[model samples]
Target: MSYHFGRGWSKLTPYLLLLPGLFFYFLISLGPSIATGFFSFTDATGIKGAPIRWIGLDNYREFLFMGRASLDNLDALKRTLIFSFVVTTVQFTLGLIVALIVNQKLKFTNIFRTIYFMPVILGVVIQGLMWSLFLYPLGGPVAKFLALFGMRSEFLGGQPTEAFAWVIFVQIWANL
Candidate 1:
C-alpha cells in the first residue's frame, strides 16, 4: 500500500507543480484573447457601464470591404508583408553565413562570435538609442564620417525613402 501510494504521488507531483503556471497562463494570455474575440463581435465602447451590443462582423466588414479604410489597410498589409520577407531572408542568410564562419577552427572565432552576439544581448530600446545617436543629423558619427567625404544629410530624420532604407538597414543590423 505504501509503495503504491508513493508511486501515485510521484506521478502527480509534476502536474501539481504545473497547475499555478497553467492557471496564470490562462488568466494572462488566453483570457484576454478570448475577451478580445468576443468583443470584436460587439460594439464595446470600453466606457464604464456602456451598453454593449452584438454587431455581427460589421466592424470587420467596414475595415475590410468599405471605402478609404480598406485601401489604407491593404497598403499597410502589403508593407508589412514586404518588410517581413526582406527581414526574414536577410537575417537567415546572414545568420547562416556567420554561423558557418564562427563554427570553423580559427584563432579569433570567439572574438568574432562575441562581436556578432553583442547586438542580440542588447535590449531593443538600447539598440535604438545607440543607433539614433550614431546617426543623429548634427555631430553624429555617421554624419561626421559623411562630412569627411564632403557629404552631409539627415539620416533617420531625412527624406521618406532614405529614412525607410535606414530603418531597414538598422533593423537587419540589430536583428543580426
Candidate 2:
C-alpha cells in the first residue's frame, strides 16, 4: 500500500477534492440569499441596472405598516408562502409514503419512482404555465370537472379565496 506522511500536496488533498461542492454551495445557495438581501435594500426592478437606489428597510416597513397598500402584492405574497408550505409538506409526505411502499417490495417500483419524480424534472416556468392552464376558468380540467358537480365558479378567479385555494391545491397536487 502506498502511503505518504506529512506531504505538502497530500495534506491539502481533501480540501481540493471538496472544491467543487464548496463552490456550488456558495454559488447556488448563498449567492441568491445574499442577492435577495441586497435587493431588499434597494429599489431595483426587473430591469437590470435600472438605477437601483438604496431604500434601506422601506419596503419591509411599508409592507408591514401600510393600511392601504396594494392588495395584489400582499395577496401574491400570501399565496406564495401558502404554496411553498403546502407543496413542501405534501411532497415530503408523499415521498415518504412512496419510499415505504417501495421498501416493502412493491411491484413496478422503477415506474412508480419515475412517475413520482417527473414533476421535479419539469422547469418551474413550465410547471407554472401548466398549472395556469389547468386553473383557467371554464376551460381548465379542474373547472370542467367541477361543473359536473355544479361547483364550477371560476376556480382561479373572482376572489382571493378562490385564487389562493387553487394555487395551494395545484401546487400540492403537481409537486407530489
Candidate 3:
C-alpha cells in the first residue's frame, strides 16, 4: 500500500520548485509590457517630470480622428502601416523562395545557407550603419552605380517613392 502510489510531497515538490521560475517569467516578460501600456495613456515624459497627467484617448484620437490638430501624425501612421505590410509580405515571399532553394540538393547548399543567414547573425546597429553608409544619397554606392550607367537619381533622398523603393530593393537584395 505504501508503494502503490508516490508519497504526498514527492508529487508536489516538482511544482513547488517551479514556482520561482514562474514568478520570474511574469516579472521579466509581462511586467514591463503592462507597465508600458499603462504609461502610454499618460503624458509622461522625462523633461516634463514630476506631475503625470492622464491624457485618456487624446493621443489615439488626434492620430486617428478627422479634423485633428496634427495631420502629419496621421500621414505618418498611414506610411508606417503601408511600409510594415509591404515589408512583411516581401520578406515572407523571399523567405519561402530561399527555403525552397535551400531544400534542394545543391552543391553549395550549406555555404548558401550560411551566406543568407550571415546578416542576421551580425549586430543590428552595425548593419544599420552599414546600410546608412551604402544608401547615402550623394556619395553612396547605389548613386555612384547609377551614375556610371548615366542614369542618375538621388537613390535615397530624391523623393519619398524613390527612397521607399530603394529601401525595399536593398532589403530584398541583402536579406535573400
Q: Each candidate's TM vs. the true structure?
A: 0.76, 0.56, 0.62
Quote the positional error of residue 158 for candidate 1 in Å.
2.6
Order of candidates by TM-score, top first?
1, 3, 2
lDDT of 1 by residue, 10-118 (tens): 8787789899999999999999999999999999999999999999999899878899989999887887787888888998899899989989999999999898998
Judged by TM-score, which candidate is best?
1
* TM-score: model 1 vs. ground truth: 0.76
Error of 2 at 129 (Å): 7.4
lDDT over C-alpha atoms for residue 163 of model 2:
66
Best by lDDT: 1
Q: Candidate 1, clashing residue pairs?
A: none
Candidate 3, residue 96: how far the Cα is off, in Å: 2.4
Candidate 3 collision pairs = none
lDDT of 1 at 119: 89
Candidate 2 TM-score versus the reference: 0.56
RMSD per candidate (Å) reads 3.9, 5.4, 5.1
- lDDT winner between candidates 1 and 3: 1
